[model samples]
Target: MREFLVEITTTIPEGTEPAEVDRRRAAEAVRAKELAATGNLLRLWRPVGELRSIGVWRAGDEDELHEKVLGTLPLRSWMTLTVTPLESHPNDPGKADAAG
Candidate 1:
C-alpha cells in the first residue's frame, strides 16, 4: 500500500437546502468510519475556522486511491482534493518503532 496526504476542501452550493446538507454530512461521516475500518483512512485534522481538512490515507496506488477509495465518499462531488504521495524516510519515528 502507498500512503497519501490529502487536503480536502468542501463547498456547498449557494441556495442548497439546510436539510440536504445535514443529510450529506451524516452520510460523509458514515463513509469516513467505513474507510477507517478498512485501513484506508489513517488520520484526519481540520484547521480552526476553516472548511478544509487534511488527512492521511492508504491505497494500492493513485488511481486506486482516487477511483476506489476517495471516489466512494458521499461528498466527493462537493470536495476538491489535493493528494500527495508519501515516501518513507529512514529517520521516521514510525520506522524506528517498527525496527525496535
Candidate 2:
C-alpha cells in the first residue's frame, strides 16, 4: 500500500462560536476513529498554523483516499483537501540497517 498525506484547510463558518471549535475537534476525532477501524488511517495531526489539519493515510490509491475523506462530514464542510504521495526516503541510515 502507498502512503499519502492529505492536507486540509478549513474556513470557519460564519457565526460559529469559540466553543464550536472544540465541537469540531471532537467530530474530527470520531471520524479518525472510524477511519482507523477501516484500516485506512495511518496518522493525523492538527497543524499549528492558519492551515487547518493534516492527515497521513495509507491506501491502495487516490480514489480510496478520496472516498475516505468524503465520508467525513466535518471534512466535507470545512476542508479544501489535497492528496499527495509520501515518498520513501532513500539513503537513510535506518533503511540501510533494516536491509542488512
What overall lDDT goes with each candidate model? 0.96, 0.75
Per-residue error (Å), model 1, residue 18: 0.9
Question: Model 1 over residues 11-52: C-alpha lDDT tens digits?
Answer: 998898999999999999999999999999999999999989
Best by TM-score: 1
- Please, what's the RMSD in Å of model 1? 0.9
Once superposed on the true structure, which residue ranges of model 1 sit more than 4 Å away at CA? none
Model 1 whole-model lDDT (C-alpha atoms)? 0.96
List the candidate 2 regions with Cα displacement exceeding 4 Å: 16-25, 92-100
- Candidate 2: 10-residue stretch with minimal lDDT: 67-76
Per-candidate clash tally = 0, 0
What's every prediction's RMSD, in angstroms? 0.9, 3.2
- For residues 26-71, could you state the per-residue lDDT of candidate 2 as single tens digits? 8877988987887788777887755666878877887867775544
